[model samples]
Target chain A: MSVLTSSSEAEGEAIVLASLVEGTAPAADDLEALHRRLELAADRDRMLDLAYTTVDSPVGSLLLAATEKGLLRVAFAVEDHDRVLDVLAATVSGRILRAPRRLDRVAFELDEYFARGRRSFDVALDLSLSSGFRQVVQRHLPLIAYGHTETYKQVAEVVGNPRAVRAVGSACATNPLPIVVPCHRVLRTDGGLGGYIGGLEAKTALLALEGVGAR
Target chain B: MNTKKPFEKVVAEHGPTVLRVCRAVLGEHDADDAWSETFLAAMRAYPELPADANVQAWLVTIAHRKAIDVTRLRLRAAVPVGDVPERASTLGVPGALDHELQDALGGLPDKQRRAVALHYLGGLAYAEVAELLGGTADASRRAAADGMRALRLAYAIPERTGAGK
Candidate 1:
């Protein structure tokens, strides 16, 4: 059957409409400024209030997130930025926005650490994501010293559960905050590099950055 | 399965399109306010939104409501003003040809304007546009067609000799 309306006429209308849309589109900078203003409004409203930013590191981009309380999560690029954000949305608050100023201290500390100018992170941390034994394990992980290593069994004993070596490995494997918590410092009792949440290569690199050789 | 991503990704992906729709419906001066309000509302309600929900459609819907509110506010504010010549030159549409198109668009009836904007700029289907505008799909399609025809007539220019027509 023949169409009543001419196809070319409809096509011309579509082209004109498309051009009208293009000509009226707002500038990129305007949109960015609008986003910044919206972010400020959201922050002032104090709804859930999780802010995040990305930092470049020797390994790759790190997603750093924080709350009003303190720095919350630091994730590696391998974890996938989307997935990491989803996790943050689920565990912390879905009210997440990328406001880099909130993570300034974390980024600065990370930059210093990567450049070998800082030995330990000084930012406040929110450990609500970890609990009980895992929390205990993570709390002790940073005590491993900047340039030293600890066996899984030693970590287990340090947390007051010497026989729970496998549990210590699990804690390290599931550490909510990895590099900041220094989970990479825990190794197998046989002096071999153990599993790291950031991957074995990242763990080795971190150890190398700390002037320790992963055997 | 419903999937969710960071709100940043959502904004980065859809900000331009939403801004275009806002500018089309509200003009440049008020579009920024409408855009800001739409995203603020969306961000506030984002967590409760189903993961399977059409994010762009959802955003456009919020924008539609915000646009209506902005239009109402602008109309209310227009009341106390003295007679002043409208600043045609400062209209947000960039080039001369598109400026004519925009002027023609502004002259259309309200239903036709909303129908054309939802269908063309917001990229909604006839049925969706009808639903948003509280009309039948056939009615929405007719309004858009009528608006387009009017635009074509209004936007036409005389041919120039030895120059691109």
Candidate 2:
């Protein structure tokens, strides 16, 4: 029996194994069809509440996620897309699917903003990720206007708490919706660029993209 | 906390592998049903799965369950007493080779067949295969070896003869 199980026999087994996998594999189109069917099924069952897709921008790939409530999270590629999804899966329903149709309006707005065709985003905002004073600060960001700057102190005062300057900074730093919320426009009292969750480069790029000069 | 991705990414990464496992276990005709059921069941349970869980192994385990379900359903349907239908031919390149290999795989006993499919096609280790099949790891290994030996005799001989011509 050992004589029959030589190197040639091992090679033969490998060949057979290869043939077996290759032969019975389902077609690529079939898998795609299945995915579409599953997507519809999940949607009908109301299980896929969070839908997301990646959109190319001047900075890099941006992960745009949405729920029926509205556009929820926009993450930079530098933040690690996988980690972002994990957080969404944990905090939000893990019923997330990459159905780009739900993000069509958001993608279009982002594209328009990057192309300098739009000054303000009209997309619906979902602030479920933010709460308390942080939520108050986020709601005030859009009032700063495009191509303009607001000191954290100014934002703190706008939300009716000038003493909450540091809180304003923290809220902007953790802003779940960056570009859409216009958090990059928040600056230091000394006219400094301050911090942005998408990294300083993206902050500078978004500022410059809006013609803010980011100085 | 463990990180989890959207089910779309999961399907893109592992759909083909799962399909192969299903086909290896249930053959072509019923593999589609098994594959669909596996993913549907997986999607339902994906959210509750621990973040750090091994996704491929998890998927293969689901495929194993789905394959068993398919087999049971097929057994029930097969009791009609009419002549059994022929295995449908696959399309495209290597169709003939695939047909021969499918025939060779179809000739094995159930345990040996599953051992070879899970270990060789599904890329599971003998220990994992044993865990899925409820046998000792050693038993799974022996079954795979025996199955492969039989497959070589059944599948490789024709190729060798054709090449020699």
Candidate 3:
């Protein structure tokens, strides 16, 4: 497991990195690496299991969580285990599945959240990052507020690595958690909302929710 | 949970749900205040959270409720005024996109705009957008499609043969 895991992780990081630089959807090889990362993702939620639930919203259905760790993860149109697994094996991990019970709260509450000013998340979580820098990045994730975004340069400063713009970009790209980690909040220093793993449209929509005009 | 930190960990995981809600509910500047309020509510209500339920969704729902309350307050506090114009300027504003594409986007209905924003701006899945806006994926898609269609028709983007001038 260790040897396969190490190899998988190394390859996964590479794929994720490539996708980031190129601005494209991850490929099969990329999913493989992600899977390794998932298996190796921190056991912060060790005792807790992967659970989920479906939440209703304006756009579509959301897989939410009711786990002790709060909302674990949310995926969209996420059927077809083979493909999801392929993605998992390449980027996140095969260990993750439809965690309905663990994430049901996401479904139950997101509608209310979308409609109002209510803040603070009550769910616990498995951050699932693997490096010191990654951990540092996660630390700065929550500082970003709604309706606003921070630049990669700004994130580098917050993480105490003012010059590591590339690293900040990498962190945003490799972020195990997307919406939860709030990587969308990271943008370009030139007032441009930067790349988001979830998709540029989603990034824009999230920003637009703030009534932020445009880029 | 071994991978997560205590209070902060869970908050980090689900903060976006609240943020997304607040973004739609408040102004670009007021969002943080709303977000803080949501989190404070979460902190206050944290102890009573269900032991085995999905918590992230719960927090989002709570945030939504809070957002509605605030929007109501803002609407109520506003004073009636003289007749207002049907459209406001989205062009030439500092920090505005100032592009034709932006103008077309500005012309969309609020729901359509929100849908397009979630799809094109927020990076959420169509399903996620549906979840955020309380609609279906098809509806979200159509809204986005409609938004794009309007842009295409108004700006003649699809009809243009040239890549760029």
Candidate 4:
């Protein structure tokens, strides 16, 4: 959570945060029934117009964050129920509402992606962050495909600058799209795994899944 | 310029945790895609994350959705994941239990399942889960304990590597 210097802003944020974490929110039993799920993250009044999602994903229970603009955040290893809600309120000034229909649609699409090596998603994206070089990085990231590894130099080459290896790495390091762009597929010229923005292990795992060379 | 905010820092720091969660919930092959998707989803909107939000819980929610979504879709389109066992299936559980453990875990209500898996697999404290998930500490405890109880009842056969080994 950002350090709130303004007591009023802090107080308002706190109230919004408190409202988000007001109660006991749990996922529904039916894996497919995300819409019926109501999380006790906040009071009924607080989640008035927010997008509510409790997705049964590969990673434990995932709580998706979205607004009319599109998905805002995706949390993992959900702990500290109150803190989570507070963070959400702080992110978007408007009250956090739990509209299941809005989030469930994203959940359904994500389900398809995981059920296999999903090459595409039907969910509309906000893509607000991918601009300039970041957009360039995202555009080239996915072209690496599954199981193929390219050195930073190679990525630079693909980006049309064979000499800009380090720059390419930086672009990749800050890549907005990790999977759609397959950043894990990027590697060093040697067989060694390159540094991953997430971690080498995750990078290795992604490569392995695509049957990339694993030593 | 420390342009990246706390939520972004949270994503960078806890990327593995998110990936691990996805793997545990989704499966190996699909976990990476889900993990990437989770972050991609986060990037698009994390810039505007509420100042006081529980970053971890937000990520967990994403991981959970992406993992389940991809896994379910695979179940629909690919050969059923079924009961095929692999050497690593024991995961660090020491006990060589069958997929029944996962099946029982899968059977749990979402909150309970998350509590158990986070505490057990992810090695998170109940308090941590509570804060991220925005639940009372006691509530997190119950969900985790209840999940364990259900697994015990469902499996009945001791840890396949059975008893303190």
Candidate 5:
């Protein structure tokens, strides 16, 4: 491991390094405490640009991410939360941290929604991830309302693009915020569950949660 | 094509190593402050850091600056009597391994201590440590070796190789 040293010299440095490491490794508890404290300080100083956390729900573990502007994305465990965070890092800003405090309000709201104690989400959203037609389609999704279902064609019409029905389906399929955006309420014209970002079971589960009988 | 990862990943990957470096350089009492300051500064500048930048070295550089600031403050604020009572009495007992290690590291000359911390704890190569310390890589290796020898002698670290016998 010693790049510039002769074999004997390298072994000597390695032994010293090992002994120092063994002697001075911080306690696990101390490292954990320091990590927690650093995140909080980062948050308070507004140094953290994007904050994320995971919340367990009836669906599965939901990844909640937010910017200073609002909640940016909600991801399902199936989507691979790590990949989602990486995409967020590459696209948005790399100053993302797993700071749960920034996401506490959203987590609570999601918990309430899963428990059927709430209907609509009061949290602000950052829809910057989607743009143009897809963004238009997603913004209309929340208007489908709790406990109400709309066909993909109907959503296409509502967005003033009846010919863009396929695009509307694509938008719902790619909906970044998933459940909070209420994309599950958009069904096939014949009433079959066409597609969902969180998979068919999650779609059925969400529909059932919203008091909509699954077909 | 920004290939940089989230700052959280950087912190998670290198946090323990950085903390160890801080403790080795600043001692347990002042390490936390240096660590917090280092990462806070890192988070602020993360967006602007080049994607290919050696993130661990960047963090250590910030930490090195923070350590200097803390050391300056420590020197100005040093009072022989004030810190004696604050060290937990329990720490004085034998078998307190970290305290013993910290004392050993604290006793080193500045160049040796820094060389040991940066090369061994910060995971920087001798060349990188030299860049930060303004000297040749060979000189850094020598300083670190000297520091490590002293630490082993003070802390009673046994020689692992039978070649020494």
Candidate 6:
């Protein structure tokens, strides 16, 4: 069982070979540059099925993902960016890369929104992650004006299903694009802060930023 | 229970090792090209890869085919050259070329070099190496051992003793 003869010794050989190969593992920046090059190539070839990047926001790190269609999903730090990426890889397409260029517009919009300089997101939306009633609920969420708060009941009524208030709440809870889709604008009928996928502080911050004030 | 991680995670974890294998097989100048091609192809097909598949081995397999393609392309290009010189340092990934080790690796027979590189640098098992290079696991094991012994002798890698066995 010396390090040479066994198949398990392959790892041992890697340990020894790591030093002898091209001095050291090409510095991290080198690999990153190579990765970026690959991202560009993939993009040029139209093979980049999903591209994502993170943006620092008032909420926390926001992971923004997009497809060729448009902005696909927006997730908060609480959602675990890695796990969210994994879910994206599994369900949507594993042809995903952290190519920030695709999300530049999304990040810019978020920055403007958080700075209280923008009223609504003007970016294209890819509502493919939601369908049926959920998709309809998400599509209607953006119409609830920036400074205005819509109760779950009101949103349900507007969506032509007044009996589906709790359904609307679930739709808001599961809204794939939180800030950009404006799920934070929907509230409990009593005006108590409702559930937010980005967490309550984020919801509160977003509403405050929009001049809704804390209820 | 979707356990598949992002392709970015796959690249982050396995990128270096695959780069080493590419460099070991095709030297520095062409290695990055092979690596870029390998990952791009892998990324394209990654959605269909089984969740539990061995990603490193899968990547090495792809790298091997890309390396072969690069070698064939280089042969066809036929820019006459002598020994591959020590690379000048560059802004991007400094090609800290160890010419002696590169020469020793280049001196090896093709199968032996491929065996050593795929098994050691690429971290593929003997069976996987056999699948790539087309021989028995035992044969890949032997070729890798022979290649390593030759490399150690030529490059004068000091034999360590009594660390653990």
Q: List CA RMSD, all candidates.
A: 4.3, 4.6, 26.0, 20.9, 4.3, 4.7
DockQ of each: 0.37, 0.38, 0.01, 0.01, 0.45, 0.39
Q: Given candidate 5, what's the lDDT at residue B37?
A: 88
Better of 1 and 6 by TM-score: 6
Q: CA lDDT, every prediction?
A: 0.79, 0.82, 0.52, 0.54, 0.83, 0.83
Ranking, lDDT, top scorer first: 5, 6, 2, 1, 4, 3
Q: In model 1, which regions exceed 4 Å deviation? A: A1-5, A90-93, A213-215, B1-3, B82-98, B157-165
Better of 4 and 5 by DockQ: 5
What interface RMSD do all candidates show, one decimal each? 6.3, 5.2, 18.7, 19.9, 5.3, 5.8
User: What clash pairs does model 5 have?
Assistant: none
Summarize candidate 1's per-residue lDDT along A85-165 as a digit string, tens digits: 987776666778888878888889889999999999888999888888988999999888999999999888878999999
lDDT of 6 by residue, B1-165 (tens): 445787888889999989888877777777888899999999888877888788999999999999888877766576556864332111123265466666777777888888988987887889989998898999999999888877766766444443333
Error of 1 at A117 (Å): 2.6
Per-residue lDDT over A103-174 for candidate 2, one digit per residue giving the tens place of the 0 to 100 score: 999899899999999999898889999999999999989888899998999999889998999999999998
Please state the Cα-based DockQ of model 3 relative to the true two-chain complex. Answer: 0.01
For candidate 6, state the interface root-mean-square deviation in angstroms to 1 decimal. 5.8
Tell me the TM-score of candidate 1's A chain.
Answer: 0.90
Model 5 residue B117 distance off true place after TM-score fit, in angstroms: 0.9
Q: Report the lDDT tens digits of candidate 4 across residue range A144-183.
A: 6555667887777777778888777777776533444466
lDDT of 2 by residue, B1-165 (tens): 644777777888998898888777777767777878887788888878898888888899899998888776766666555664442222122332266767777777778888998988788999999998887999999999999888878864443322321
Which ten residues in a row are the worst by lDDT in model 6 chain B?
Answer: B85-94
- What C-alpha RMSD does candidate 4 show over the true interface residues after superposing them? 19.9
When 4 and 5 are scored with lDDT, the better candidate is 5
- Model 2 steric clash pairs: none
Which segments of model 4 are wrong by more than 4 Å? Answer: A1-63, A67-100, B1-165
Q: How would the docking of model 2 be graded?
A: acceptable
TM-score of each: 0.86, 0.79, 0.39, 0.38, 0.89, 0.87
Worst 10 residues of 2 chain B by lDDT: B87-96
Q: Model 1: per-residue lDDT, tens digit, B52-84? A: 888888898899889888877766666555763
Question: Candidate 3: deviation at residue A141, Å?
Answer: 1.3
DockQ class, candidate 4: incorrect
lDDT per residue for candidate 3 within B1-165, as digits (tens), equals: 112123334544555544543443343234344555565565455545655655665665565556556656555565645654332322223321224444554566756655654555344567866887777998988887676456545554332232222
